[model samples]
Target: MRKLNKKLFSILSIVMLLLLAACGGGNTTTESNSNTGEDGVLSAKFGVISYLTGAGAAYGEAITNGLKLAQQDINALGEVNIELVIEDSAGKADQALNAAQKIMSDDSITAIIGPTLSTEFFAVAPEVDLNGIPILGTSTTVDGIPEIGDYVFRNAVPESLAIPAAIEKAVERTGATKVAMIYGNDDALTKGGFEVMERTAKEMGLEITTIETYQEGQSDYNAQLTKIKNTNPDLILASALYNEGAVIMDQARKMGIEIPFVGGNGFNSPQAIEIAGDAANGLIVATPYFGESSDPKIVEFNEKYEKEFGKKPDQFAAQAYDALFIYADALKRAGSSDREAFRESLAETKDLEGILGKFSFDEVGDVIMDVTVLEIKDGKFIEFE
Candidate 1:
C-alpha cells in the first residue's frame, strides 16, 4: 500500500512541474512578441505606403532613402530594432487605400508612414484612423489632413502655410502687383495650393490676372500659358506636381514668358530643376528644409544622404528622415508597441530638433515648423534672401 501511494505522489509531482514550465514558457513568448526581446532590446514594425513607381516616384524615392537612413541610424543606436514593410501605392488613391488596409491587417505594425500625396492620405487615413493605427504623413500637405482623425499625423507643412510664405517672399522680392495662376484641379495637394495662393494673393492686394486649371497628368499647358502671357502679369503662381510644374515652366520659358514662378510644395524636388533646366531658374517655393543650410545637422545629413544616394536630399527626404526619429522617440517613450500608447506618445512630441529645424505637432497633429523660402539659381535651391 505504501509503495502504491509513493508511485501516485511521484506522477502528480511530475505533472505539476510540467504544467508550471508550460506557463513560464507562455509568459516569455508573450513578452517577446509585445515590445522587448529576450536580450532587452526594444523592437517595432512600421508600414510605409509610398508612390514608388509613378509620376511621383522622385518624391517616393527620396522618402524611401531618408527612411532607410533613419532605420540604419535607429538600429545602430542599440535601443530599438525597426523593421519597415514598404508598399508601393503608385500615386493612386485606390492603391493607397488598399495598401493601408493591407498594412493595418498586420497586427504587429505599430504605425504607418506615407501615401506620399495628400489625395492618397484622404483615402487611407480615414480607414486607418478607424482601425486605431497611427498613420503619419511624411509628404501629405493638404488642408484638413489632421482633421481626418486622432490617429492621423503629419510632419509635412501644409500648403496653407507654405504657399503664403512663398508668395510673401516672392512678392517682396519682385514687388509684384499682379499674378497669373495655374494649378492641377484634380489632386488635393495642387488644388489646396491654388486656393491658398489665390487667397493670399488677394489678401496682399495683388490682382489675379488669370486663374487656369488642368488635370494631374496633363503635359501641355500652351493654352493656359498663352492666356497667362496675354495678361502680362508680374508673376506666375503654379500649383502642380514636379513633373507637370517642370513641363509648364519649360513651355512657359520657351514661349518667352520671363516672369518668376512662385510654385507650391510640388516644386521642392530637384527633379523640377532637372526637367525644366534653365526654366527652373528663378522658380521659388517655400519649404521646411533647405539643403544649403549651414547648420551642422543639415550639413551632416546632406553629406551622408548624398554619399548614400548619390544626390542631394530634398525637402521630402529631410521630412521623412525626421519622421523616423520621431517614431523612435515615441516608441521609446511608450515603452511598448501598443498602438494607442504610441499614438499618445507621438502627440506629445514637441521641439524635437531635426534637419527640418525644431519639429513639433499641434493640437490636431499638424506640423508646427518654420518655413524657408527658396529659389532655384543655377540649377540649385538657394535660400531666398
Candidate 2:
C-alpha cells in the first residue's frame, strides 16, 4: 500500500504540472518579465538557433559574428532595445525544435535566425510558424523547406538558384556530354543538389553519365573517383559537404583525373583550398552573389572585419551580415517590434540591395538571387562572371 501511495503521488504531481503548463496565460506574466526593455517598451528579442559547436560550427560562428555586429549598430541608432539570445542546436532537429520553442514561449523574441541544417530548419519552422514569429534560416538549401512555416524565410540564396547555375556553368564549359554525379545520398542539401543537377543534365540533352552515392564522413573517395574516371566523363559534378568535397577534389587530382570541376555552395569557402591545397586552384563553384564592390560602405565593412578577425570576408560572412541587416530592415519598415508586424514588413521587401546579392523572396519563400560563379585562382576567389 505504501508503494501504491508513492506511485499515486508521483502521478498526481505530474498531472498538476501539466495542468499548470496548459493553463494558458498563467505563466506568461512570469515569462514576459525578461522581455521588458529599459524604457519599458518591451524591446524585441531575437534568438539564433544554431549549431554553435558541431561540424557546422564554422558556419554558425560566422552567423553569430554578423548578428553581433548588426546588434551593436542597431543599438547605436538609438532605436528600441534589442535583446539577442543564442542557443546551440548541436546539429540536431529535436534539440533545435526544443530550443526554439523555449525561446518563443518567453514572449521576448519577435524573430529568429536559425537551425543551421536544412532538416533542423524545417523541423522548427512549423512550430515557429504556428506561433506567427518570423524565422530566417541563414543556410538552408533544401527544397520545400521554407513552406514549413508561413513566417519562415531565409536570407541565404536557395538551392534552386545556386544549384542550377553550377550545373549550367559546368555543363557549358566542360562539354561534359557525359558527366558522373557523385553525392551524399542522405543529406538533404547534397540530395537537393543531386536532384537539380540530374534534372538539368537530362534537360540539357547531356548524358546522365552515372549516379554514384557516398555517405558523409567517408575519408576514402578513391573507389568512387576511380569509378567516375572509368566512365570517362568529360566533367565531374560533386554534390558534397565541405570536408568530403575537399577530399574528393584532392584524391581526384592526385590520380591525374583532371576536368574543370564545378560545384555548389560546398566549394564557396576557403576550406576547399585548405583541403585540396594547390589542387584547389582553378576549381569553380556557385554562390549567391559575387559583389564587384566599390561602395564605401562595403569598404568600411571589409576594413572592420579585417581589423577584428585578421581575415578577409568569405561567402559565409557575407550571408551572415546580410541576414542580420535584413532582420533589422524588417523591424525598421514595420515601425514596431511586434512579431506579426515585422513579418508583414519583411513580406513587402522588394529588390533590396544586400551584401551578397539583391534579396527578394519569391512566392514559394525562396530568396530571388542569381547564382554567382566563383573560381579559385592563385589562392584567391575571383568571380568567373
Candidate 3:
C-alpha cells in the first residue's frame, strides 16, 4: 500500500510540472513579437497611399522619397521599428479607397500617411476615420479635409493661407490692379484655391478681369488662354494641378502673355518647372518650404535627398518628411501604438522645427507654418524677395 501511494504522488507531481511548463511556453510565445516586441516596446506598421502612376505621379514620387528617408532615419534611432506599407493610389479616388481599405484590414498599421492629393483625401479619409484609423495628409491642403473626422490631420498649409499670401505678394511686387483667373472646375482643390484667390484679390481691391475654367488632364488651354489674352489683365492667377498648370503656362507664354503668373498650391512643384521649362520662369507661388534655405536642417535634408534621388527635395517632399517625423514623435511620446493615444499626442505637437520651418497644428489640423513666396528662376524655385 505504501509503494502504490508513492507511485500516485510521483504521477501527480509529473502532471503538475508538465502543466506549468505548458503555461510557461504559452507566456513565452505571446511575449515574442505578438504585435508588441520584447520589453513591452511597440512595433508599429504605417501605410503610405500615393499615386505611383497616372497624372499625380510626380507628387507621389516626391512624397514617397521623403517618407522613405524619414523611415531610414527613424529606424537608425532603434527605439521603434516602423514598417511602412506602401499602396499606389494611381491618382484615382476609388483606388485610394481600396488601398486604404487594404492597409486598414492588416490590423497592424497604426496610422496612414497619405492619399497624396486633397481630392483623394476627401474620398478616403471619411471612411478611414469611421474605422477609427488615424490619417496624416502630407500634401492635402484644401478646406473640409480635417472636417472629415477627428482622425484626419494635415501638415500642408491650406489655400486659405498660401493663396492669399501668394496673391498679395504678386500684387505688391507688380502693383497690379487687374488680374484674370483660371481654375480646374472638376476638383475641390483648384476650385477652393480659386475661391480664396478671388476673395483675397477682392480684399486687396484688385479687379478680376476674367475668371476662366478648365478640366484636369486637358492638354489644350488655348481656348482659355485666348480668352485670358483678350482680357489683357495686369496679371494672371492660375489655380491648377502641376500638369495642367504647366500646360497653361506654356500655352500662355506661346500666346505672348508676358505678365507675371501668380500660382496657387497646385503650382508648387518641381514638375511645374520641368514641364513648363523656360515658361515656368517668373512663375510665383507660395509654399512652406524653400529648397535653398540656409537652415542646416534643410541643407542636410536637401543634400541627402539629392544624393538619394538625384533631384532636390521640393515642398511635397519636405512636407511628407515633416509629417513622418511628426508621427514618430507622437508615437514615442504616447509610449504605445494605441491609435487614440498617439493621436492625442499628435494634436499637442507644437513648435517642431522641421525641414520646412516651425511646425504646429491648428485646431483644425492644418499646419501653421511660414508661407514664402517663390519664383521659378533659371530652372530653380527661389524665394522671391
Candidate 4:
C-alpha cells in the first residue's frame, strides 16, 4: 500500500508541473503574436477616447456613430480585423489624461483615436507621443496640435484654415467694415479660433471694434453681449463650443442684437441649430463636409449613415468616418500592424479619396482638404451665395 501511494503522488506532481508550463508558454505566445492571428490575417487593436457624456456629448455621439459605422465596413472587407477599446473622457482634461494612460498601458494597442476636444487632446497628447503610441485626433481642430510630436496627427481642419475661409466669405457677402469678436477664453479650441479670426479680420481690412471674452459653461453673457451690442459692428464673430455658441446666439437675439454671426468650427454641429432654434439663423461657418453635397461618396455615406443612426450625419461624424478609413488605408500600406510601420505609412498618406473630398496630410500631420462656407437659413445650412 505504501509503494502504491508513493507512485500516485509522483504522477500527480508531474501532471501539475506540465500544466503550469503549458500555461506559461501560452502567455508568451499571446504577447509575441499580438499583431496577427493563426490564419495569418493582420489584426490590430485601437483605443478611442471620447467625451461620451457632458456638454460636448453631441460631438462625442456623432464621433462614436461614425467610427462604429466605419468599423463595420472595414471588418467586412476581410483584409484585416480591427478592434476598438473605447473610453469616455466626459470632456474633462484630467479624465482624458487618465484614459490615455490606461489605453497606452496595453502593449498590443497599435494606435489611439480622439479625446474629442482640443483641450482634452492637449492634456493627453504629449505623454502619448512620448510613449511611442500614434494618437490621431478626429475632432480636435485647434492650431499647433501636430506641433506636439511626430506621433500626433489630426484629420479635423484647423481654425487657421476654416476660420479664415468663413471670415472671407462673411466679408464678401455682408461687406462688413468692422467686427465685434466674442470667444471662450478658458478653452484652447475657442481661443485658437479667436486668434485666427482676429488675424484674418485685420488682414481683410476690417476694423476690430470690440473683443469680448467669456469662459466655457458660463450662462450669463449679458455683460459681454451688451458691450458687443454697443460696438454696433457689422458682424458678430464668435468662437465658442456648441453649448456656449447656442446660448450666446440665443441671448444676443433676445437682447435685440440682430446682426449676422460668423462663427468658428464650434458652430458647425447640428446641435447648435437645435439648441438655439430660430436664433441659429444667419450663422455662417466653414466646414469640409456638408450633408447636402451631390458628391457620390457624400451621398452614399449619407444614405447608409441615416439608415444606421436614424439621422443625417453631421460634420463631426463625417470627419470621424473618414478618419477610420484613413487608418485602415495606412494599415494596409504598412503590411504589418507594427506601430512604427503604421506611423510611417500614415505620414505618407496623400490624395486618398474620402467623403471630405481629396484627403491628405500635410508635413506636420494637419489635414489638407477643401473648405465650404455655409450659412444657416431657415434653420438649415446652405451654401453662402
**Top candidate (lDDT):** 1
lDDT of 2 by residue, 77-195 (tens): 75556668898888899999988987887676789988888889878998889888889888887777777767888877766678677777766665668878889987888888888
| lDDT comparing candidate 2 with the true structure | 0.77
List candidate 2 stretches off by more than 4 Å.
1-43, 79-81, 289-299, 309-312
Sequence-dependent TM-score of model 2: 0.85
In candidate 4, what residue range of length 10 has the lowest lDDT sum? Answer: 25-34
TM-score of each: 0.86, 0.85, 0.84, 0.86
Q: State the lDDT of candidate 1 residue by residue for 167-209, as single tens digits.
A: 9999998999999999999877788889999999999999999
What is the per-residue lDDT of model 4 for residues 267-337, given as tens digits with 9 covering 90 to 100? Answer: 78778889999999989999998878788889999999999999988888999999999999999999988
lDDT of each: 0.90, 0.77, 0.86, 0.90
**After aligning candidate 3 to the native by TM-score, how far in Å is the CA of 344 from where it should be?**
0.8
Alpha-carbon shift of residue 299 in model 2 (angstroms): 4.3
Model 4: lDDT equals 0.90
| Cα error of candidate 1 at position 132, Å | 1.3
| Cα RMSD (angstroms) for every candidate in the order listed | 12.0, 5.6, 12.5, 8.6
Cα shift from native, residue 175, model 1 (Å): 2.0
**Pairs that clash in candidate 2:** none
Question: Which scores greater on lDDT, model 3 or model 4?
Answer: 4
- The better-scoring model by lDDT among 2 and 3 is 3
